[model samples]
Target: MLLNQVPVFIFLIILSICEAKQLLDEEFGTDDVTSGLCDDFFHGTPWPLPHDSKGRGLARLCQNQIEDGKEGRIVFATMFSTTERIPVYTANTVVLHRDGKEHPRPGSKYWYRVSLALCSSDDHTFDPIESMIGHAEKHEMEQCRKFQAVTEDYTHNGLNLDRGHLSPNSINEQDLEKQLGTFTLTNAAPQFADFNREVWRVYECVAQHTILDYVPGEKVYIITGTHGVALDVNNNPWWMNGDDTDMDKNPVKIPGVYWKAFCYPGNKTHSAWGYAIVQKNENVYRKPDYNEYITLKEFNTRGIITAPFGPSCMDASFGVFSKVFENWDEYIDTKCPSYTKKKREEL
Candidate 1:
């Protein structure tokens, strides 16, 4: 199907073009954060299900919406359908709140109306999306329920496979071993190899070498998934270790609970700099800090944050560049990606 035939395509193209123009205008020192994604990105709340006309709603009690770079610290969202499935529209939303700053908090048992487009259903090969409709809850269960977790090899419906991050391998060992402990299978994702290999690496450097001071015992907890979460049994949204109080016999050890944080830099006391959970498929990692992003100046937005990590590093470690970049253009222009440069002794 040609783009000229679809109105949604027009929307994406128009937005892309506009974004391109905007980027061209301010080529150097881009502070613009296209923002985030699934699972850990939408924790502590009930995710909306697929609707009749609105596709699927992602509004939850604890979701931090993205922002429009052109608009000072405002949440932003987009609706698009793969060239294959036109009716199955995918609504991607992201928010850039100032950790330690004032902003809206997406807590548990809350209400939100972010995005819900009627997704298209025109499945075809290379149909504008290499990624398929990801599984929601059970997606990550392939290994979550299995003890002695398989760290290296894991898949979610076996789709857009990339550099699946299981532990703090050679890629993100930021000087601290326990902090790098997040590199466990419980902390992996289905990100593109280029993203994990090239771009996200830059963040590791900044997080380890650049941001020196941090609160001790600070840790990052992460979870990622598709569809609505059960808030039980599943391991994509929340993976708090040892939290089965209401049940008998501990079936899991990963932390399936929300940690703490403060607001980011720029904004008021709304959001925080704690676990910056990011994901591609059934995998999620607790981003201790979006360091590479700090230079972009994310301190002047939003207001408020109230969590344990409360926006500070919880004896945490490591960092990753955003994965919003879908293709080469993204890898080049936006991300200043680095790669695993660890020596033998470093490991």
Candidate 2:
């Protein structure tokens, strides 16, 4: 169908359907994330989804209501794993907090489940979305519970797991609707309390502050995700040996490692640069130390990360860069010493 000739509302509907087809196509997982799908949120160089050999992961364009009462503005994109009931990764360009003000958290019970009916539509020739694009109905939610994690999975389960967000709320605090978009259960994983509230939070802050402080107007794309699966205390340990999780027995897969990658696309003035960091999921009280941060080369060496920013900015390696740039004020100086020297020469 020719979309331009249709009414604006009809155009939107058709566009959404086309997007769904593109996102859910079987080959979408194998394609680079920067394949022009939701380029606005990805900054034209989105990170690729982690490998899902079982084909349980689905690509979703998360949307929320805008000022015009329309609900299709793409907030971010995620590769949600239906089997593990958590997002493998969420790729989004940071939307800085408005005027240094953070949005207050929403009331309790704000989580929503992805619409299983739409995701698992039998008429389509693509992988099922498992409802990350829309909210599921009561009956649909029940059916989804068989393969997806539900709100109840995190409640009173005797596991000290917090619903950790892949796409954090603080980065999107400027827009209430965008912040709320991060509350979906499909966008979360079972995170340890200490790790989630402590070091992981610090990592998120550093990534956000890196953009807000030094590179204020630059587009900084971030991809946060899980690496390995954690064993459930009550469930069989052998099940955790592989990527696949037994959803009926243990629906939520606590991630063994959490990682974040960020890219700053430089303009004509300077070249592009990006970094990645990883941390174990176990309890760690203090802030993340320098060694936790690594270059994209090291990230790929450790495995799971896929694709780079087209052989330029994304490919530049930080060979001997500092492990941690404690002060954001000195980030450009300490983190990018060579770049700093170049800037000094230009001055």
Candidate 3:
């Protein structure tokens, strides 16, 4: 009786695995990371401009409604590097928070993977968020384990890295759905827990506050990104070691730096302005300031951030010093008194 039951269990396991593979094949038929797929999020400009992503193993996913066939509004956009197993950048327009409160973060189990299969030329389509909200089965998620980082990747990882979000949940608190949407694994990167929770959190707040306070009722685009290779918990550059094949090891490149950039389109009263911050993702314990700030042009020129605000939006005319920091008055007094003096002379 025991032997007979063992064969039945073995057969059931095979059946489940096959079903998971079939569903994945049908849903993720082709690599839809083509050019101009999510241009609306970039002010109609193709991101990572000046460099074509064709054959780069990068997947441009436009995160939309989670419900299959529901076709909900786009929550945000992400350029995922399949090779790095991390997001290059996530772009989204900052929405005004109506009540000044943040939504509760969903449980860790809610995070999602965009696809199990990397790329194909077939004619089928797979929605990035289709697996969320009860659309995917337990066996289906198990299949993703083989190809991409799952919740378990960050768990017990020797580095003790946090699953840092490119598009932070706090900024999207205006809409609960959009806030919850940031939980996808494709939108995450391995970050030092101290840096992610403390330093980076403050930077995110500064970006959100600057836009909300100064440019209310207008669309302000914010882009968060990562760069460079990070060190392991023991300070070893594991990525540099070519022969390490341990699946439990860090699967993605832990970024050495994290940056955020924003663009505010000018109206009749104001000229278009933008600001960016590139901070080292080390164990620093200080609030972000103007010292870390770099002009959007410098950000692109240095190759730290490639065309972060997009080509059409980032040009010679955009002013980096138009708005200095959070407190405009304090900034004028301490940081750049000449800016206001220059403005007065021009007027």
Best by TM-score, which number? 2
Q: lDDT for every model?
A: 0.27, 0.62, 0.63
Candidates 2 and 3, the one with greater lDDT:
3
Scanning candidate 3 in windows of ten residues, the lowest lDDT window is 116-125
Question: What would the per-residue lDDT of candidate 3 be over residues 74-97, giving only the tens digit for each residue?
Answer: 678876666566777888887684
lDDT of 1 by residue, 1-347 (tens): 67657998788999998898676334422222322333332223212122221222111211122223221121111122121111111121212122322223223111111111111222211112212111214444333223222322322323233423332233223322222222332233334344455444444322332222232223222222221222333434432223444232222222111111121222253222423332222233333233323211121121111121223433222222223222434433333333433333367
In terms of lDDT, the best-performing candidate is 3
Error of 3 at 133 (Å): 8.3
RMSD of each: 19.4, 11.5, 15.1
User: Considering only N, C-alpha and C atoms within 3 Å, which residue pairs clash in candidate 3?
Assistant: none
Question: How high a TM-score does candidate 1 get?
Answer: 0.26
After superposing candidate 1 on the true structure, give the runs of residues whose Cα lies further than 4 Å from its correct spot: 1-160, 166-180, 213-337, 340-347
Worst lDDT window (10 residues) for model 1? 110-119
